[model samples]
Target chain A: MTEARATMPPGAGVVMPIGGAEDKLGRMTILREVIRLAGGSAARIVVISTASSLGDEITHAYLQLFAGLGVSDVVGIRPENRDQAGDAALVATIDRATAVFMTGGNQTKLATVIVGTPVGDAIRAAHLRGAVVAGTSAGASICSEHMVSFGSGGSTPKFRVGQVSQGLGLLSGVVVDQHFTQRNRFGRLLALVAANPGQLGVGIDEDTAAIVSASGRLEVKGRGVVTIIDGADVITTAYTATGTQPLMMSGLTLHTLPRGAIFDLTTRRLVSAPGLPDETEPPKVATLADVPEDMRPRTRRIAAEGAHTTTAELRRRPASS
Target chain B: MTEARATMPPGAGVVMPIGGAEDKLGRMTILREVIRLAGGSAARIVVISTASSLGDEITHAYLQLFAGLGVSDVVGIRPENRDQAGDAALVATIDRATAVFMTGGNQTKLATVIVGTPVGDAIRAAHLRGAVVAGTSAGASICSEHMVSFGSGGSTPKFRVGQVSQGLGLLSGVVVDQHFTQRNRFGRLLALVAANPGQLGVGIDEDTAAIVSASGRLEVKGRGVVTIIDGADVITTAYTATGTQPLMMSGLTLHTLPRGAIFDLTTRRLVSAPGLPDETEPPKVATLADVPEDMRPRTRRIAAEGAHTTTAELRRRPASS
Candidate 1:
């Protein structure tokens, strides 16, 4: 296993391993990794697990778990109202801290209450400032640019298709699906990719983290791997057909990055660093023009504003012809 | 408030509220409205709440709350894996439910765990089956076809550009935004409308819900008003310099639906239905082809494809003629 180090910038972000806490080792490892990434220590940690995880209990269990690792300075953010005011306080906390962690829960609740508020803005600012922010499970899923808002089943694609709701576009130009392989989400991700070929699809496995940097560099960490589904080279047309389904995509790329692998988002290429080991054959890179003829949506409406000429007359009269 | 009930057919869905429990009374009212829509309390109800919100203590509180309301057979599914299994469970739960309610957390989390899952399929199935599915805050936002993923905040139309992402596409042809007036998300929604003129943008205020039917009718409920931003009749071309920013939109229709008001998604008109109040002036209904010349995207590719003309002929023949 590759031993990961944390590099925290100056800002506050809470990294809580809300789920899988039964595995103390895994939780602690993730917490330590977040601390290192945020360039902070456990002492400076302010745990905010009170909203959900710490019900009735005094949050002592969590504090003890952190204290066992020499972590202190934790505080819980239990808001009276799960509305705008509460969101404001959460933002104030984030603004005051060097790193603030958001434990896994209901991403919709978090986004609904926080998005478009001071706190949401602060979180974005912290990320842009390179304050190592991390989330697991639900938290991890919301960190992407285009998030899955929930959709219908079926491996096939449909038109006027996809129930895409909003997401926190922290990681731009990419759509992320968590628990990828374990969940058989390939079809859904593919559908999303088909809908927006310009965006990259990232399917992350359980117990895995695809840590992205400020400059669009990605590093895969944890037990599982990160699958990159690039539909940039797909050749399907007409995503919305009633009976006839869209053509199956060909010439697309799928890259599986195991632990310690790095990917570049800008060029959509894998960086061959010394420490990183390549595990599988990389897929073919795609360009904008490589998009299939049919799948390309006709986004424009044209009117023949000028004179209509006959093909035969044009062919005979044109010197260029 | 125009207390018109939700009219769901037999075997339709039941929507539950869990995240915004602070609005317990409002939540129950919305629940009653959903039940009414699904055709009564006999309908099977699916309670979808975040694991975090259903904390050890709160879980019991919720269990008691529902039990008191004569609702039983509730299946609680906490998504341990943010992928297919979680979604599958949700779908399965919905499959047995006539009404499904989504508790809020992070909209992204709900989408990440549910999009492409059996649960997502179930939700769609229920919707098709005339089930009254309801989501609050984050849940409400995901109900539309095109949802706001999160954009740079501003009140101007220009600030809404470059922030759109793929949503679950539940309500096709509409964009849904939550925490509307409270957060001042109008600018972003407007930009979204201008960006995709073919779609209707809906901004749902907090503590409110919009019950939409398969026939494309929308009824507003709750405290604040629902803002409908319609840019289908835009008439400007040169909104941006290099076609980067969305073209400046003109003749945009802004409708504010207070409690009890109903809006039609298809006709782009607000009907004077009994009990449901009319809130805005009727705007001219325009199709996608009616957008202004300059504002419309260049259709040269489609024109060339349609005409079967070579680029050489288009340029040289014109000069020679």
Candidate 2:
């Protein structure tokens, strides 16, 4: 993985920096999406479990999941070292693949084993030539130019407790954090963006995937939402702070994109989704009779028909007194 | 905080480890419980927001909340550096505090500034003299002797991604993780316990509180469940591997405790809870009338009798899943 700007080239295939912690068997919304991006059942996919301790197990798992999805020409690759990462046979497979998927593991291992190798170059070439490229967890972390190698967190964002590393640079000017909501990584991600200022922070929730097109259109798809932190125009003295302290940044724009919401990276705005703030009327609430028969008696879950996770009304409503 | 075995001193007062992301005003069950433990309105409580960047805001918020609850003597402290941490004025106040409450922020900030200070010593002294000590988030992370300083996580446990550091030794032989279910810190906690089999991992969910008496009885409180990972008799080769890898451990017991459940930390068993696995017959399902009038038309909610989150039968049945 070359350390370059996180911009997608023209005619480049779809970039799937899948949020980590995806279920391989149940639902399979994400894996199936990757296959669709790779041209459906006819797509030739290469599964790389280089970051896993159970590499063989993960490789086998992906092979089963992909095969079950009706893709016949699926292959698994496990590169132990830089030498294996540069294997001519593996490089050739990567070049011929329509989709490349990397499994979850320690991002550091993935970096040492595959980054800067021949296979890494092939993945780049394949991605540039219009082949779908996707990774989960550590894989997702590497999708952006800057990645979070390690970080200490609690409830609030602070200074000097996070480490950033170079990634494959498929998406530049953005740092990706996986298992986002599930791991409560907002603070750490905020800390990174505060220091860097040049980069945006994309925290992807578990079971979610961010579909980045060559034209800079980002579509969120999954069970949860994606949190986008824009700190470019923010003001903070955290960069000049001498000792460790909590972060203080103002004017940072936060956007939450739920499933089916479409955002444009180039425009830095929401392109398509229901309930835009400028709309005349937002989504309406439903009564008990409008709910599903099974769930109506116990609860009436209002169907959220918008790109946002919480409305202005909901956010104003206090969690407690 | 001294690094010691995880055992409570006989004369020590009650310790409340609250999970993170709680609403201070509404549904303030955990906070109310802490006040009650401190002997109600007559209690002198100290609020430490040193762990928070919004410490001033948190202090003000808690002061109002506690005052609303009828606690007249509420003091606030903000120790930013080591020198301030040893402030005699603050130490004197902490010593006399009937209940000491620390707010959430970055755990590292809490540990570094207060770990070896006079303030930390005063807190221990107060607790030993029968004063309640309560902490939330970063505060909760610092209650145990060995704290999870940093950890990379997913849905499954892995090796080397977790690192433990010293914490305020209010409790030993146990590591605590906040936002357990919501943030999915289970894998990270499991990795910690797998490596150090003698210690148990307590993963507390948000809005919840675990009240541990000096005699070692633990009662779960609040809206969510507490996941306890016991690795006392686990066997694993994960401890041997050097690089990042999948964790391998067997015989690890998992227990989920909800509100009203009482667990005996001394005996490493649940003393009082309605549904014991050894019971001859489980609970029966409820009818529509068994639920409240408002909840009658849809799903039937089983009244969680005596410590169960739901019930034995409800646990056996599936939700929307």
TM-score of chain A of each: 0.68, 0.83
Best prediction by lDDT: 2
Q: What is the lDDT of residue B177 in candidate 2?
A: 86
Residue-wise C-alpha lDDT for candidate 1, range B202-257, written one tens digit per residue: 77666667767655677766555556666555433323313223223334555555
Model 1 regions lying over 4 Å from their true place? A1-321, B1-22, B50-65, B80-90, B159-162, B236-247, B273-321
Please give the clash total of every predicted structure, in order: 67, 11
Q: What is the DockQ of the complex in model 2?
A: 0.02
Q: What is the C-alpha lDDT of each candidate?
A: 0.54, 0.76
Per-model TM values vs. the true structure: 0.39, 0.47
> Mind listing the fnat for each candidate?
0.00, 0.00
User: CA shift at B242, candidate 2, in angstroms?
Assistant: 46
- What is every candidate's C-alpha DockQ against the true complex, given to 2 decimals? 0.02, 0.02
- Given candidate 2, what's the lDDT at residue B147? 87
- Chain B TM-score, all predictions listed: 0.70, 0.83
